[model samples]
Target chain A: MTSYTDKIREISKRLLKEGKVDMVIGFTRGSVPMMHQPMFAKNQGDVDRFVWDGNCGINLANYVTDRKEKIGIVAKGCDARNLAVHIVENKINRDQLYIIGVPCTGMLDRHKLTASVAGEIESIMEDEAGKTVTISGNGFSETYDRAAVLQENCSLCMHRNPVIYDELIADKVPEQSENDVDRFAAVRKVEEMTPDEKWAYFDDLLSDCIRCYACRNACPLCYCPTCFVDESKPQWVGKSIDPTDIRIFHFLRAYHCAGRCTDCGACVRSCPMGINVRAMTKKLEKDCLENFGWEAGLTTEQRPPLDTYKPDDPEQFIK
Target chain B: MKNLLEHMGIDPGRLHFSWISSAESTKFVEVAKKVTEEAVALKSKEKKYMKTKPKVA
Candidate 1:
């Protein structure tokens, strides 16, 4: 609920002005202040434009891959997780990053909230303590529990605190409980299905796929500049949109994201088809938690479960 | 019954079929198309449908 813009900007500007950081990365108010987008700041002027709120959706950590030099960045809880993975993979230099940790209580479900209102957000203001939301229309204002309209994933967030950070501005956030992880019930329904029924479900889901890799692109873990699917050298999933290849692409994505994913739910949000894609990751995430006791993007020291092998490791995949 | 993929100009010889056979009447072909396209795309150029030579019976 803390809009740490002034603090972040102040720090970022100081860093930039003093040459401690080459640039600062944070959220900027979008076309309408209701929505927000990322901004790469070089100086105080650019830093002044940075803001943070629920509407800041995209995982800006994806931008840090393959970059050099010192950079200060504003990180949400999810962004912090993604950054941790990057650090573990040696894809990012942690020493170079001045992470300004921002605690997100949760985000507003804009789609549902907009419909609840008069289809327009007249104004949004910080609550007295700066820890709640107050939506106003012309002059009529309503203050409610901030947790009510959070995004599905945010509501069920397990990693709300920045796993990696140089500075934490506000109070330490709370840990996520098992109940915070959703999509288990939906996954269970599928698990109870017969083989044919499962195939039918996948068939229905994949058929709706237009071969667009929005799910891949939205994923912060999917940072490979040139992905295998895009490999013309040995074309993995072609542009043909053939059912099998499309199906494999989906599987490939799921498997690739398996232990590497932070369960940020970007893949679901960005999907044009709205195939309940989060359901898959959520299912996989639950399995990872229940079976392996591993959560992705939580730490740089802990290897992604799939990548690291131990002779003593439980072989659940054993026949 | 005419195959759902028949109108899609797919090569049956080069194709792979995944049937989501169910007890009830919910056979959706639109979903079938997605799997079909993916199988076709994922089938590498080096890997051909190995047609078995018939034994002289």
Candidate 2:
């Protein structure tokens, strides 16, 4: 994706030089391998530090909330969706910013890559043309098919092109067809389990949780000024890493994102324990899609299903 | 909230929602009876989310 990086630098430089925006948000290589950190470029000089590749998994939309300054942001498919959500929520105005949209071809899953190799990965190289990834550490170097290591949410993504943008970095990539990807396959598997079995499934899944809140911090949807977990007056969830507390935390967090989540996979990516947190959120997403014929971030003009009242809304669960 | 809780393996019967006004006393009683029956049926299953003594310490 060298061309992507070059184009981003050129655009960001021009935007900065023209004083169109006070800052530009993008990704830069992180301190470690297979991790990219969000970089804020306030001037033309810092624009060169911006880079884009498979490791640019951190959603840049998380940084733009409630900002007063005019901004230009590098948004991939998921980030752009989150931005649309932000605009709909009135967190930021559309006129105050410029969106540099990039057509995304999924990101690599660090957990999958790390698990496939034996030692610490020293470097990672992507062969965009060949659709292969090469990783080297110490005396070992190995290559693997890119599709095999793609993030789970990305592989199942139907929207690989930004839904909204001011400018495009490349021609829009073909989106994944619904027939090609069963986005709810994992949720379906969980749904098929008995209540006791499902309980055990999530219990085992959250067993490694450290209550670090990395997932919440990483999520662009989690922009609450006072998150439920931190509210001392009404302690909705215990601070301890008790299984019940962890379960409640996950449940509530997913609930909060009910109609707003884009299934961007930021929570799963940020989890230090490698927990698949999307399992809970995706169920809500699936329900929203099936019951309400709604997909979050697709359009800013319409409010999400949960946010509005409709007489025809399903009430099958009601007595 | 109820749908998600059920999706996570909680018994669908454990939680109930109804839209009965105070004027509709008969409907309220019927809904309450159904909810109680469902909760009683699930009494055999172990409580899932109740807090217990810390496992870490």
Candidate 3:
């Protein structure tokens, strides 16, 4: 596989040279050493500043969606899918975009991966042998086995291939999860538990929460200009660390995001509280898939499953 | 998610990770320290594992 640096340079050069786009929103090495964040390039000098690899991990769709100009983006599989969702949401004008699709195996969890080779990480790049990550530290340079060093999500990604893009970089990768797992099956199992047991588990879990709203901010579907949590007219959820308020906060956010959520797993990853709230989202995704035969954002013709309702729809479990 | 983080090198006993509706930080700092220690320990293990490879079979 070609390194993203080369691919991004080629795409940027072409976009500028052909006058096909106005700007390139990609990623480069972060201002902080060893970190990676989104980088925007408009001029040729900045094109050389672009870099792509597992390290270009942040979903850049949000940046592009928030803007109103003609822009080409460096999108990996997930980022591209998110862009598709944004397109359907009407948050972005699809015609204005020139998507440079890059197939992604997955992204490394930077904190975990960097610390794994702390004081190393001389240069990060990929090649035919897989990720050619060369790390030099403490008077030694060691090469890590690419696949093993890849992020956890990359190993089990169902959509390594970009769903939509103007260009293709590699042969599309296949979906990873196929089993029709009853998403509500776990919730049902919990329902069977005594109320005491249910709360016991919940209490055990939420006790570590240090209320940082990373989940809300990370979500692409949660595009409310003003969230209910911040509204003081009703004081929707308590300001302090009240446990019930926390519960209500998460439940409301997830419900608001229901049907809209793409199950990108971004919310869970962004949570400093470490709540893996994706469990709720996965359940919602399964419901959308099984009942309405819908997967969010894959098609422009379909309405969000929760947004539409039928008289005969199953409400047996509804209180 | 707990299981997944464990793979990333978090030990629940020390670095308690859970949903917000569940926290009881009565001993917040003590608990935080324990969690930090565990995370650091796991990171160090990854450092060792990643740095040196065993003899190939």
Strongest candidate by DockQ: 2
Candidate 3 structure quality by residue, lDDT tens digits, B1-57: 222222222233433643222365655666567667776765633432121323232
TM-score of candidate 2 versus the correct structure, residues matched by position: 0.97
Expressed as tens digits, the lDDT of each residue in A1-319 for candidate 3 is: 4465687798798897787888888888776544577778887778887876666656777786567788988888777777877887788888889988887767655445566765755555456656555556566666667767655445545677777798875556555674722334554555455534654555556556667877777777767778898888886876555555555576577677656665555665565655657645655555666666776666555567666788866654321
Cα lDDT tens digits, model 1, A36-82, are 77789986788878876777767888788889978898887888998
Query: Which candidate number has the best TM-score?
Result: 2
Candidate 2, residue A141: Cα displacement in angstroms equals: 1.2
lDDT of every predicted structure (CA atoms) = 0.70, 0.91, 0.65
The weakest ten consecutive residues by lDDT in model 3 chain A span A180-189
TM-score of model 1 (CA atoms): 0.74
Pairwise DockQ winner, candidates 1 and 3: 1
Identify the runs in model 1 with alpha carbons over 4 angstroms from their true place: A1-3, A32-34, A110-145, A179-183, A203-208, A316-319, B1-57
| lDDT-sorted candidate list, best first | 2, 1, 3
Summarize candidate 2's per-residue lDDT along A13-85 as a digit string, tens digits. 9999999999999999999998899999998899889998999998989999999999999999999999999
Of candidate 1 chain A, the 10-residue stretch with the lowest lDDT total is: A310-319
Give the CA lDDT, 0 to 100, for residue A301 in model 2: 98
Docking class of 3: incorrect
Each candidate's DockQ: 0.03, 0.73, 0.02
Quality of candidate 1 docking, DockQ? 0.03
